[model samples]
Target chain A: MSVKLEFNDETLLCKLNGEIDHHTTLPIRLDIDERIESCRPQTVVLDFSNVTFMDSSGIGLVMGRYKVLNELGGTLEVTGLSDNSYKVMRLAGLDRIANIKKGGSKNGNQ
Target chain B: MVINEFKMTVDSRSVNESFTRATVSAFASQLDPTVEEINDIKTAVSEAVTNCIVHGYKNSVGRIYIGVKIHNDGMVIITIRDRGCGIADIKKAREPLFTTLGGDRAGLGFSVMESFMDKISVRSTINKGTTITLYKKISGRAK
Candidate 1:
């Protein structure tokens, strides 16, 4: 998986691509966490517009990140989830911890 | 009657998780499943295979067996077997967010499988192996 990171309006946005399963989550998590440590954005945003497939590992990724950001007093948000991804996210109870929105590449600006 | 079935074995490696999901989904395409149905099957398959690689094997390499049977009644039955360490407590393992694995594990594999598939059952013998079977019906065409 590939992650494109940017900082806009005090938010660190990560755009993820390709399938996300147990195998591909380590690197993505490490990269995002490292950035969260270095940049220390007020809110860490994950953009899933290009994520083709995801399993429970996606939930783990989000949940783990939520803990990391919360510990650092930062917030988390996710955007651009497809119908199925949103279901998985909600199933894992991520909706309660993170601000998740459904939209395309526009970055939740529908 | 079983219209068709497929089985394959792969190494208990993380890289094979995605491959297994795609292969199973491709074989499932014969049922003419919808995109949502395909995603559901793929997600369930991923969770099963991942359980084998991440938890069952536990840093060791082994063989993971997967079998799929497509019945004439539009039901797809998938069985994933792993010759790794079996689960000590099956009931606890099936609970949501009760994972023993660290480093980005939500302990929701079984929960995901249960939610995505119509039926799921698990059988395990400590130090022997574990097998999880999933059943789902394609609401599209049966034949």
Candidate 2:
């Protein structure tokens, strides 16, 4: 899996692609955690629209991100998750912690 | 006639190695498995080897014992064994999304194994080791 980072003054958007299995998680975790610390944006959003497949590893990644952002006093949001991704997220109870937006809205903030 | 069998050793770093797995899975594709079945087998194999590397040896240098046997009854059996930290609670570990190593694991390995294979069994102890056996029948399935 590959993760693309988009940074602005207010948000740090993470666009993840490919399968989120064990092989791809460690590097992604370290990289994103470092970015979050350095950038320290107001909000962190993960766009899963492009993700083709995901399993529990992906859920753990999202939970880890939420914990990190919450500690930083910044909120976390998820947008454009595929149906399968959404199912896994909900099953893992991530839909409660992270705001899972349905549409492809650029400004996820209400 | 004796059926074909294959064996390989996989390290944690090489657990993501898909080429060999793809080849093996392709050979077994003649069974005409459903899409979910194929994905489950692949995921289970990946998780088992990963567990050997991550949880079994705790990322230390170790080898995963893997054997693929085609039974005369037209059944495919894949076994992965690790001589590392054995599981304390196989039942708890098998629970979906229940990982002992925090983010170090996804806790879906056993679940995926059960989902993909026709039968899955695990035997382990505290320090001796752990063995995961997966079985799938190769008959009456469509490609």
Most lDDT-accurate candidate: 1
- lDDT tens readout by residue for model 1, A1-110: 98989988878999999999999998988899888989889998899988999898999899999999888998888989888899999998899998898776446443
Docking class of 2: acceptable
DockQ for each of the predicted structures, in order?
0.92, 0.31
Question: Could you tell me which 10 consecutive residues in candidate 1 chain A have the lowest summed lDDT?
Answer: A101-110
Give one digit per residue, the lDDT tens place, for model 2 in B1-143: 22768787766565443543455566556566665556556656766777777788885767778888776666778888888999998889988877877654556667666765789999998877899998887664422
Please give the lDDT score at residue B21 for candidate 2.
Answer: 49
Cα lDDT computed for each candidate against the true fold: 0.92, 0.74
lDDT of 2 by residue, A1-110 (tens): 78989899779988877777776778988988999999998999888877766656777788888889888999998888765566556766777888996547465532
TM-score of 2: 0.76
Judging by DockQ against the true structure, name the best candidate: 1
| lDDT by residue for model 1 (B16-79), tens | 9989999999999999999999999999999999999988899899999999999999999999
